[model samples]
Target: MAARILAAALSLALAAMPARVAAALDMAGVFDSTGPEITISWEYLETPGRKAEMQAVIDGFAAMVDNEFLPRDPHAGIEIVMTDDAAHFASYMRRNYPAIDIPKYGVFVSDGRLVTYSRSGVGTVTSLLLPGLLRDGYDDLPQWAVTGLRTYFEKFYGFWETDAAAGQRVVRFAHGYHNPWRLQDIRLLLPDLKLANLVSDTPTVDGTRYQSQQRLLMIFIWKEGKLPAFMAALRARDRKMYPTYLEAVFGQPLEALQPRFRAFQETILAHWNLVMRTPPSQVYADRATFEAMTASVWR
Candidate 1:
């Protein structure tokens, strides 16, 4: 009788066990542990070269995010779903609403689901947003910070030239200098900017251009002769810092900096036209290509 009762109890306990765990178990509050694993559905995944290229992009984004933002306050195990089409992008965002917002630059999402759509041949983290601001974890970062970060990335990591003598980097337009942006630019504002915003928006005011330019200006102020003084001012974040730093760094006031900036711009344009005769490669179809090309260029 005792053995029978024990056996019945064991059977009942076994019956209570679930056949499968919940499919949506929250992991670290950012990801759904039970949801499908994050994937990079690149068409080129079958090709060894393409697969590696896609993997590098994933790795780059992870590095960029980790270096730029997440270290301060890592949430849950966030997963990134990389898609190449508008249909997939829309589906991903819709399925992951409240956790996402498409901004003027790119899709800004929380620990929930997020997707980066890059039709551009070369997908780079610098082109998306500055790693610094992302690292800083500023969801509502000022316009200056956004532009500053963009400029910083282009100056350092982009397939462009930076000249201390010229002081400004010439940004080649996708259509022309006047045209808004090319496929590369799209990566800069994916998942966030609506089609209308992309069409109408111009680099004006304290917008993208200003922020970008400010980065160069900041670099000029700090790295050049006025660095020590500029650092002191920056630490304070004082309104007067701009003027004092500007004077110390450039030996000119804010009003005087524009013409100098223009001069630098002209020098850059002339130099860009002279040296960059060939258009840079649009897509790094695989990692080897990117590695081969950038191996010498990037450290």
Candidate 2:
């Protein structure tokens, strides 16, 4: 009777403990590096050559942030986690950060940590580094702008595999114009959806497509030497001020620019149709599947 009572008491005590305290991770063969701007925690032991290759990728990413993106020194350096087992990594994150939300693909936590389970590659590196840079450099920018900058970087500097038989050499902008058909879908929806509403609203599949269009629009504005002023207006954080800013930058009122923008959109669609020999509408018609996937991941 006495032994049974003692065992019951111990079980109760264990059950009362916090989940984080109860769930301790035992990571094996983890390798870590602390650089000036980023700290990488790789969850696998790497050989000397592999370590050198990863180090070079990290260094290149740091240099890009320091030179092109970071307007000021980051208050806390970014922490990055690379692992093959995303589910396991997410479980550990949940234990420590009970109140915080974890994104399906890596996320930038409030405390300057970027945890990811992405395979080591140029695309993954770009995905992780771009968010960190945007978070550090333009923390006050709206989500649309932050996401736009990331897509812009990927469109210009990212790589894609061409031939599986030829090993892993990647070519830049391999998708050609960064999701062109998706941009057409956004253009088709624009008469019903306003730009300001699209930016400020919760993310949906259509909203995601709108964001891609906005990014392309921003890139076009940048090419016309108007991005600096436009970004300045966004930094002011007044939605009402956008029309005036748009006029100043584009030399036309918002309504006038729509017709011009529509013309530009048509030209892009025509060019892509000529190259790919497919209608943009038919190509991007599967909205239901895309929305379901987005909802599931975000949920």
Candidate 3:
């Protein structure tokens, strides 16, 4: 009888203790009240502000190309992992993708994983990232795809034009201006653009030079012609018959369009274009001093 009483008393004491105090707590879930609606897991560790800035860039990009493609669907939201250290980044990549060649700076992936090397050949590779996203090219993209995407981005993302005398033009950076290129109407200045007769991504074309040409052509289209219709046509695959598409678009054959495109090219050359200037330097915030410098620049 005494043993029974003692057991009952102990049981009551245990039952009376608060659940939280009595049980092992899962601290990780404390702040994670909601389940994963859209899971984003990254290897990169960032401060609150930097993380927020990255999120904003993601949001802006989503807004730019959302539902533009067929099926009228929102892009499957992505996970952007940022690494604080190169060692960690490399470890993550090695663990996740063993076969990929590491990228030069950072990689962009749509359907496939992008491995960015801290360096690529002799130069820092940044253009590779932007075009990767724009074209959704996983591992490989043709020269045309690269050039075409570059052209598309320059046009959609408007810049500050520094106009000088004697028909010189310079593009200044615009703050938070999305979709610089206006691709709606391509008629007002058709003759010169037609003269250039620019076709992006042809066989035997110099890719780097072609990309530069494509950017200029896009600018000319926005300034002189109906850009949106052209974009629509291109997107719809109606442009497979290139000359016919041109004729239908401008009510003229390629011969008529050639002279105009050439003239347009001349005018474009007259401007002090920096669309394809020197490549950008790789940005690393690993060092405290470098981080401070970057912060100051942003400030």
Candidate 4:
């Protein structure tokens, strides 16, 4: 009798609340906050310090997006949910987003919301929003610009320091991991891998490689102080006409650029070697150790 009474009272209380508030309550033990560009909600597991740090990262990310990518303010503010438990998050997401496949660590729901099930540490908060940002901004950008800019911002948020130093590290990593095939050989292997093919929403292996190549190209442009002009050109023209615009901006034909691309690859390799020789600093104290412990859950 007492249990029945308690259940009735609970239902009645929920019925009295606004629909949105009631729905929010269904995902119990969540804390919500509103920022200028985003609304964030997280599991109760987040400590005060961590929450503040995440907010700061989000603010910084928003500033970068406004200044670099979007010509107008976003149509809608983004929503973010950080879940403490992976299994629980997955179940909730499956119920809410039945059509989308949920990744183990993060997912961007169709409703312009980002959901992340893992939190490595303070420094890594930017990564949690990246997949969603990439997905959201993809349609508005040209194929070459999408991954290149995404990588550039990733390095920015990951390092949270000066752009030049972060860009150098990103270029080095891309160079170190790239295949040793010549430009002609790569072109043959990925014959259909043109900027037009990247318009498809589905992910593919060839597409991934194309994105990497674009990243390398962006790094080269950045080093040459031509990135701003390149980005302006991208914004002013349509994706189909990007190749023509590219040649115009660089004042060279595609064939003429191959030798310079090869030289850029060699420079990246040299930078990678130099970076690998340097030891890491312990500025974050035990943050690295904490991140390692949480790696299995996220990474």
Candidate 5:
């Protein structure tokens, strides 16, 4: 009876304990680096070089995502759990996510934890994570926005390269235009790309076709210098006055802006790669060199 009473009391105490305290109690010795954006705890007993490499991976990921795609402090300090122990990773993931099946790497959306295996290639990790985070961040925004933030994100990130020479490792990051996403069939989808329909609560040529169509809307608002306010309205979920917000964002009547939006979209679609998609080489290499190589894109 005493043992049962003590166990019950301890359970109550732990249940009432703060989450940070419970986490520390659970893994007192293995806590690792804490960053402004993310805290990392790892279960790797590897060489110092390998350890540093994993930390670099974590840091690079944080840098890529440290933007408005997610609101500031969305999860109140999200955490990364890195491990080389495949068996333990599998067991813990199974326990935490019973019904849903995730691959070797995943984020616990509500619990504020993301798990990654150290040996997994960097490209794999970054590609998978961006969309998940983008989807989550954009969730609070109006659904009509499709939050096109993910398309904007892909234009700058999702490419990784590594090179080492003369006792130094040089890591290179590169990004290009959006993937094909049925650009060939875009002609078939073009007729349905009216501005009003794109922004309405309906599927516009399936999800893939929405990227460039929605991107045009974002750029139009961005050019009008009201993109931030427009996003704020969406993020605040201010649907009651969103029509007013839209009028303000466009700074013109809907009929007037619709044709302007379409023309802008058409001009860019003429040469999608050259017009809008800035390649990574254009970002880092000298302008003259990139122009000679990729023709007119400035790095």
Candidate 6:
């Protein structure tokens, strides 16, 4: 009888509260732990090879961080708080972490805590590694460099589904810079994206374009194969050094690189156009070809 009364009182409080504030505290089991088993989805268990594939990706990423990128431990390791509720996560982030760029569906890291909203399947694997690399000296790393490196490693987010064929499982992953994103159609927005505008202190104030713009620049950086050199050289960095870094790292003025940049985008846009024209079956018919074409841009 007391429990029923308590529940009723809580409901009344929730009804009276503002929508945003109410949503922020709406909790349905938040697991605040950092363990491999914690993130294993039910879909992985039901699929035969999915567990192994996902684990391999996870293990490989951890190894790279341990051996190559960050040899020492972060002074304070990350405390991950994951929840299934997207509105709860968004509201909490907005209230508590106003300065951080709250991804509509991905993980966001701040202040030794890695928070994720599982409504979109934990976002891409690339972003999950942020807490690992974000340590003592990294906060000063420019936002463009940070976003670019993270988005550059991001390939796709794949999930298994029942195929039309008998006893078949098909994998469909959004394979692009905008995987698991709210904004997928950049056709109308791309025309106005310029490197000169991008290389400024802040790439964009618009939430929709900020990630995309940083990603666009990073693809060029990776294709140039100077990612390490680029990141390293920029340690002597400044907010205004982005254009200078591009010129120094690419061995050309920003003006010269613009055409080359446009050429690369043209290739990507051409591929996108062709895929739009083709039927779904034809578009995904050659997984190898599609994956190759997507990764080819980075190479």
State the weakest 10-residue window (summed lDDT) of model 3.
Answer: 22-31
In model 6, how large is the Cα lDDT of residue 268?
Answer: 59
Between candidates 2 and 5, name the one with more favorable TM-score: 5
lDDT of 6 by residue, 1-299 (tens): 11111111112111111111111011111111122321233211133554344333333233333432333332333333544456666776777688876775445654544555334332242444542354345776656666766554444333333334323433333423433232244555544456676767855555646766677677667666666567656554632444467677877777777887877767656566443432121123335666655553332
lDDT tens digits, residue span 1-299, model 4:
11111111112111111111111111112122222455557654665554444443444334433444444333455556666656767776787778868764444444555555443221123333433454443465555566655544323201111224223111001111222222223344332333323333453445546555554556666665576677677666533443554555676666676566666655545554332332221111133443442342211
TM-scores of the candidates are: 0.40, 0.53, 0.50, 0.54, 0.55, 0.50
Error of 2 at 9 (Å): 47
Q: In terms of TM-score, how similar is model 5 to the real structure?
A: 0.55
Ranking by TM-score: 5, 4, 2, 3, 6, 1
Assess candidate 1 and give its TM-score to the true structure.
0.40
lDDT tens readout by residue for model 5, 1-299 = 11111111111111111121111111111122233444556554444554344444444333323332235443345555655555665665677667867674432333566664444433234333444554544554444465454443333322112222222232233333333343443545543366666666665556656655565456566655666677666566654543545665666656676777666556556666664344331122333443354455422
State in Å the error of residue 270, model 3: 2.5
In the range 1-299, model 1's lDDT, one tens digit per residue, is 11111111111111111121111000111111221223334321143454334333333233333322233233333333444444655665667564645433323334443344444222133434343334443444334434443443332212222223334321111101111122233333322332122112354334443443445444333334454454344334443643343444455555555555545444434454332332343423333553454434311
Native-referenced Cα lDDT, model 5: 0.43
Q: Against the true structure, candidate 1 has what lDDT?
A: 0.33
Q: In terms of TM-score, how similar is model 6 to the real structure?
A: 0.50
On TM-score, the leading prediction is 5
Top-down lDDT ranking: 6, 5, 2, 4, 3, 1
Is 2 or 5 the stronger prediction by lDDT?
5
**Which stretches in model 5 have alpha-carbon errors above 4 Å?**
1-37, 43-71, 83-100, 104-110, 117-140, 158-179, 182-187, 210-212, 219-226, 235-246, 273-299
| lDDT top scorer | 6
After superposing candidate 2 on the true structure, give the runs of residues whose Cα lies further than 4 Å from its correct spot.
1-37, 85-102, 107-110, 120-147, 150-176, 190-206, 222-245, 274-299
Write the residue-wise lDDT of candidate 2 on 17-123 in tens digits: 11111110011111121234445565543334443344334433343333322333434455555444557557766876777776654433445555555332333
Q: Candidate 4, clashing residue pairs?
A: none
